[model samples]
Target: MSELYDLTIVGGGPAGLYAAFYAGMRDMKVKLIEGKEVLGGFLHHYAEKTIWDVGGIPPLRCEQLIERLSAQARTFDPTILLGRRVDTLERLERGAYRLRTDDGQSHDTRTILVAVGRGITEMTKLDIRGADRYELTNLHYTVQNPESYRGKRVLISGGGNSAVDWANELVGIAREVIVVHRRPEFGAMERSVARMLEMADVRTPYVLRELHGSGDAIRAVTIGHADDEEEGTGIERIDVDAVVVSHGYTRSYGDLLAWGLEIGQHGVRVSDQTATNLPGIFAAGDCATYANKVKLIAGAFTDAVLAVNSAMRHIDAEAPGMAYVSSHNEKFREMNKRLKRPL
Candidate 1:
């Protein structure tokens, strides 16, 4: 017989991970499935980065926050499946749910939590002329590791926050940091913009027109005006070692809707109590869209608690629907001690 869990939380970001932890607190059998190579979701990309908000927690680095959250999740010891995408979902006659992955793996669970944030998608690639030849080797859409370009000449494209942020991050590390933005004004944070102005190597009002390089590596990039219509004009070339493109991302919802799961624009539409349209199913996190939207990480934690509590109540019919409130001070005391910060 195939083992079945009481709850299956998809998307191991803040939502899914927190949901898994909360489900465990309710003494429910939990399975967490994440589509990424590792846990932490988007926050993983900026691991070393600092975060100001997250309830009572002090300004913590992204990696520290992820580590703390992961530790909390492990307290319950969930059946975690990393680097696996849940491609399909279907309800069975016995009131159970079936989940299928891209690799033909399947699992059965009683309740479902769809927490796939921003859908599962990759960023758009730089399709410059002759750029495809050395894409994998020399060019990248996302900065997987900034340290990889240390002491090397790097050219980054795009005017968005990510592109500018990378330029700021790679300033001291890379040999020369060149940013090519199509518009005269950058679309990043003011602090980043101000910092970028200090680095004169970054070029504005310029667009990357073409890429020229040989096998396995990029040598230089062709730039032109943002107003140029047909091809490149006022074309200037700059030599570089690597090119990183940070245009934007493309969202992919996998096949949740195709597999009979209800998905809304904000994510999975649920009630004030986190109950979804489907019976025995709930959702939380960036993917969930309740009547009132709470997209913050702290909000996801609260929603997960509510959803798991509600799911447990549904499983145990005799259980009362009283609001979950802790009157005791022990919980807060313990939280303070463990987190090393006041609750």
Candidate 2:
């Protein structure tokens, strides 16, 4: 029989990663399962973007934050599973929970923590046929490296924050930037939109109609008025060295929602203590919703601590309500000694 863990964390985003680390401080056996092959969750989509809101941390690229979080998650050597999509959850006869992944592997845990932030997400790709062929070349759904498009004429599609933000970021880097949006009003901060308008060539009420490319690179594109039904009127062709599409993402919770947990508009409903409707089950991160919840990386960390504490109390009613603060905790004595060793 597989060993039953004290806590099993679903999703390896900020919440799950932090829970794994904090659970170690409580001396609980932990396991974390991530659906994707890598950790970091949705942060991988904006790896090159700068993140500044995390408390006590200086501004750093999202990728650097992911690296730090992943490193911290492994501090206690918790069992980490990657590329496993959890398919079902079942309550065992003894009140323990069984989580079965799509690969048919089962994990037994005394308590389950649902931290699948926004569930499994996939970027919304460009709709134009044959657009994918250029993905390997000049077409980009994500900006992994801003330097890649330096000195190139870049065409961006979408009106959301990501689209506008990327356009603004590329203003001084790219030789020229052109933004095409279906709506006249962009769905980004007013100041950012104003900055983009003052820099990039902003085209409103427009949609990418076609791509002109040879081999694996797009050399030009045709854009049309959003309301042009015939696709023949109000057409304009623009030459470009690269194209960026930021259409947002699609999220799927899989069978997780069918497990009878209380579902809210944002996600699985949980109490202030991070306890879910089900016994021995809790939630955290964007996947867990409560009154006045803050939806940011820092907020996810707070949720992780609360959920881990709740899970600890669920496992052993006599256990302390929360782990001792790191500065005063005895669990890190050996770790601190190791850190002090000469390099």
Candidate 3:
């Protein structure tokens, strides 16, 4: 237990970090809470991937963008508590909040902003029998390091952005790269698809049938045509040194279900201002849902701003609608002064 904060944000993803910065700009005593040891959320999982979607960034790596975001977030001096899972949230008197984490640490705050994007995530597994046995050895889910598969035969399963990205990446690293998907088309960018096929063997309109290997190691895989109506299409066995499945992930809401907030299909239902049904509690990023909501990193930034503004209003009725832009903001100038160490 420590000093009560004006804002205690949950989840330290891109949205959370931005909200913390904005809250600090408003001169509120805020703390950013995170369940994972790492600060960047889902983006950290795809650190190796090149990101071209974020505005004003030209094809930067995910990890590089995270580093920039981390630098910006720390500039605000928001109290950061990592590796702490918020188990429960209690609504205290007069719109304040009390949160208890798994490690028995408690925190109190006047406002709460949930920026948990997609919650805790686990990779979708290949359903083929015994395919999971080789997870640690050959069959892989998340690509931690691309260099590990250097010059080895690789097979990637899935047609999403990750599948196409890995196919493009491993083309230079792996001896041979192959991608298998059940659908006829890929759910990736058109330019990425074009480049990936130039170097990788893509087996779409197909499905993984079996894994051909001995104990704890994969030598090859058996794949079959996805369409049964197409006659004379037999199963094909492709040799590979490693198998990477990128069928997306399974997301769990974690302890959010116990919070007694209004949960919806996409996430917690939020107002136009990003406020939840509960007073002084707000949600942003993928964990919050509103009409015509955008889900990109850029969109999450917009949502975070809205939530922070709503939180400020809730915290103090006389609070202004928004803070001044960074260039003209005195706070930013003051923060810049802090950047230079004392002589």
Q: What TM-score fits each model?
A: 0.81, 0.94, 0.78
Candidate 2 residue lDDT tens string, 163-282: 999999999999999999999999999999999999999998999999999777999999999999996899999999999999999988768888999988988899999999999999
Candidate 1's residue-wise lDDT over 1-343, tens digit each? 2589898888888888888876765678999988877788767656767899897789988888998888788766899998788987767767888899877899898888877877666677776666667867878776767899899999988888888888898999999898888887888899998898798487778888878776668788888887778675678988989988888877777777675556676567788888888888887888778777778898888888888877887778776553335445343456556875544
Expressed as tens digits, the lDDT of each residue in 21-61 for candidate 3 is 88888888999988888788889779877899998879988
| lDDT at position 141, candidate 2 | 90
Query: How high is the lDDT of residue 84 in model 1?
Result: 87
Best by TM-score: 2
- Leading candidate by lDDT: 2
Candidate 3 wrong stretches, greater than 4 Å:
125-139, 144-150, 180-239, 334-343
Off by over 4 Å in 1: 128-153, 169-176, 194-198, 201-205, 209-217, 225-233, 259-264, 320-343
Give the range where candidate 3 is weakest over 10 consecutive residues by summed lDDT: 334-343
Q: Report model 3's TM-score to 2 decimal places.
A: 0.78
- In model 3, what are the clashing residue pairs, if there are any? none
